[model samples]
Target: MKINMLAAGLLLIGVSLAAVNMYYYLEGTLSIQQVKMDSPLPVKVTEASSDKQWPLYDVKPSVGEKFAELYIPRLEQVFPIYEGTGTEVLRTGVGHYIRSALPGEENHTILSGHRDTVFRGLRHLKEDDELVVTTPEGAFTYKIYRIRIVTADDHSVMAPKPRATLTLTTCYPFYFLGNAPERYIISAKLINKQRVITWNPSR
Candidate 1:
């Protein structure tokens, strides 16, 4: 009986700690500095012989893992982005399309967030607006060029482009209370990138 009481106490302590962290995150205090890197992660993740190159990501991420943070300076908002599109992942933060290229890749990278939560402020974005994606590997900057509405079945949202592209999707009718049939896409392309330096000669 004593062992059971100790176990319960430990569990409560763990839960309380987690709650405190989340409180700071949602308050934008802790999340603001969670990801530190050089802004605009370098593009061209893959090797290229003569300019035509494949997209590559410096960081290798696992499914449903929190790998980066998405920051919108215009909105003064920051949110976490996980590596997979799991339902729970979306509930907690944005989700990266597993099949899409990672940040800094010279191709399309797709991202989705729930309109009611993480992406509620996305609709305010406009052309020429800038956003940043910060990962342990590096940081990427993109300038918004296109914002439109499409049917949820639209595959173009995931299409790769000749240049570096970033696509953010959220359900349409931002005020809707439930599953939305339409999609709102905000497409941007890489303007600058910085690669994370992993080598340490001093070590």
Candidate 2:
């Protein structure tokens, strides 16, 4: 009888251990699923509003996070705009300067991309070409007014602006084999802005 009792006790302990292991396994699976569901989705532009004032973005995007899409009408291409100018960020698409103003802001907004990648056709862009930056808050349209080639060390292109401005930078000599010695700069001024209304299915 004692042997039988011992066997029963061992069975109970084994069941309890199995239950605890199952509980933890299920919890871990749910946590991973929750994180996947919480990932941010691309913001879609629904409509354009005629509001005179540009919508202000109070919250800034984290580094390496994609917050906007740049549409170059002349190039007929759209590039995702990430928050930082790191190598990885530029490899995927355009990078926004963290210290500069964001789209629709009343200051300078700087964007950069690799010459051979996203900005390969930038050399073909001329004055009056439209560059549209669409963010969750709004869509800003800028007209290229000037194109300049400056030394790689030049920082004057980043000076403060009285009005909203967009500056695009890329390595000069579009087809250069190695690191280029000059910087190609495209200066554009905000000509129009439209507020974006994002639609959420949860709402």
Candidate 3:
């Protein structure tokens, strides 16, 4: 009986180990697939052509809550805007700085992104660089005013301003060799305004 019990226990242990291994393997595979699915599309938007707009892939902004159309002239890219700040959404496009509040509705409209990929190209900006954001109602232009560095834990950087404003964040040391400890911030202010256009008035 002891010999038989010993064999059974060993067999159960082997099965348990195999199950755990399989669980981990499947978990890793799913994580990779999520990241792959999150990858941004390669479409680019340039110019204010009435004939073209970014393919939003079924993104819908809430009614009474307007959406901003972001344009980085330097990159010749135009992307849609969403409310409530988050890297997950901003990394994909222009994300509203959750800490700052919504655009037009508030005094400041703060947006942030990953420095390495989404906002990586921002480092190329200089003082007075122009950033234009058009809403479904109107367009608000911003001028780059300054660049600064702050630590990762500095959430206060997204504080609201008394006047119309825009802020962009990314990692510091544009050419650093290792993980960046400081965050790079770009500030801007509203300039020109334009009316937002929609192809489907029925929607």
Candidate 4:
């Protein structure tokens, strides 16, 4: 009886610790989301600049692969972005589509993020929302087209239906009490281009 009680106590303690850790992790993640995004460092991509080729070290297929900046204008916040191509980064911020490659790649360039942390503000997006991706090379603007929901395992949802598309995915049923079984997806398209104001790196 004493052994059974000890085991139960241990299990309870384990569960409690897990909850506490999750709580702290979520708090930190939200705090990060509140930070201003790192503004672009000045680099021009002129026809002349494109003439000079640079060596590619880490050949990432998607935009989120490298140190790129993403902005959801509606949110009024931009945070440091990390790659999300594999299972390792999926739990963090927007992930790139492994098969589709980087943003502006042929066909669809996909990205995924945690609805609650890195992408919690996504729920606030509306039609015609402006999503911007600023790379070391150039900045591309995408117009919000639609929002959708699919089953958790619905891989088809990420496939590009329209050419030159950008897909964003996250867990669905934002208010669910437990692990969600659905997925939320957002689709947008490249619309405008602009030269970002460059400045020296703060850090």
Candidate 5:
């Protein structure tokens, strides 16, 4: 009788552990599916004349709202851009600095993401590579001019610019296990602007 009771208790514990593991496995799979589903689709674009004025965004996007997509020509990857830089927002996609100027505006436009996730390929980017941001208003193309490594607390990289500029930042040491001590910064200058006539149906 004692042997049977011990075996029964062990079997119950084993089943409970298996159940917990299955629940976590399913949760992780669903989270990945959610990120894939949230990714923004490519939009059609047309080059805007140099003399033409780009549309200005008067209303700000609400936090957690996806407003644009970042496309790296070299990597051939697209990452959705969310409004805020909160942990949850960065988990799934890039986050836009709320205080910075919008794509078409004449100031700094900053976008950041996790090194291991949405920006995993950012380390492969080189000078002169193009970064394109597509929004409902239009598509703005930027050419990488400078790449630098700065401390995590450095705020100089976020300084205002006179012309339209796009800044991409991610944690340095892409393979670091814990929090990174530095940041990788990519500075790009606007080279072209295009009007997005056809919007993404899912947006």
Candidate 6:
């Protein structure tokens, strides 16, 4: 009887620990939530775009630091983007793959997030859906052209592109109980670009 009781206690402890970890995984970005803009600013403000000289976009962030923000109109969600893909980095928000392009770099930019958290709404994204990505320098509009599920080993989805592209990735089967073997990918191409005035760095 004592052994059975001890086993039950251990099981309860394990479940409690798992719950704690899940909270951190899902709410990890809360600390950075204040940085999210109430709504993404419009890109065509003449004063901000007149000179076309953007210094904010050039602000180089240190490794694992906040680099940008993504605004999804479809999901009505804004998430902070951080540099580096380490566990600690992802805990705050989206992780920018170090090897990918930075905003306005005319190359591919790859971002990753947790399936249970920041990217949970991605499953609703459809082809042709438009989204905005804002940086200290400006705002960019991209239209999704492809949504696919690929094996985790797939690299072509994140491969270099001659033109500017944005890719958001998360574990597939959004509600899967454990680590999922497949990956969900949202691929978008830059359509409209604009330099904007934002209070991000200051706020």
Q: Judging by TM-score against the true structure, name the best candidate.
A: 6
Residue-level lDDT of model 2, residues 84-146, one tens digit each, is 999767766789999999988888999998777678779999999998888878878899999
- How well does candidate 2 score on lDDT at residue 35? 15
What are the lDDT figures for the candidates, one per model?
0.74, 0.79, 0.60, 0.63, 0.80, 0.77
What does candidate 5 score in Cα RMSD to the true structure?
A: 6.4
In the range 1-203, model 3's lDDT, one tens digit per residue, is: 99999999999999999997566444322221111323432222233434223222244454223266556776655555556454345434556754464444336777765554556678788899888665554455789988888997798777778777888887787667567888999888766443445421111
Provide the TM-score for each candidate, comma-separated: 0.70, 0.73, 0.59, 0.72, 0.78, 0.82
Cα deviation at 197, candidate 6, in Å, is 2.7
* Candidate number with greatest lDDT: 5
Q: In terms of TM-score, which candidate is stronger, 3 or 5?
A: 5
lDDT of 5 by residue, 53-162 (tens): 45667577899998887778677566678898997687667899989988766789999887767676789999999987888888888999999999999999999998
lDDT of 6 at 10: 100
Q: Order the candidates by lDDT, highest first — what do you get?
A: 5, 2, 6, 1, 4, 3
Better of 1 and 5 by TM-score: 5
lDDT of 1 at 56: 50
Better of 3 and 5 by lDDT: 5
How close is each model in CA RMSD to the real structure? 8.3, 15.3, 10.7, 4.8, 6.4, 3.8
Error of 5 at 177 (Å): 1.9
How many clashes in each structure?
7, 0, 4, 5, 0, 1
Q: What TM-score does prediction 4 earn?
A: 0.72
Q: In model 3, where is the ten-residue run with the lowest total lDDT? A: 28-37
- Model 5 clashing residue pairs (backbone): none
After superposition, candidate 5 runs with Cα above 4 Å error? 1-41, 49-53, 201-203
Clashing pairs in 3: 85-98, 97-110, 139-194, 141-191
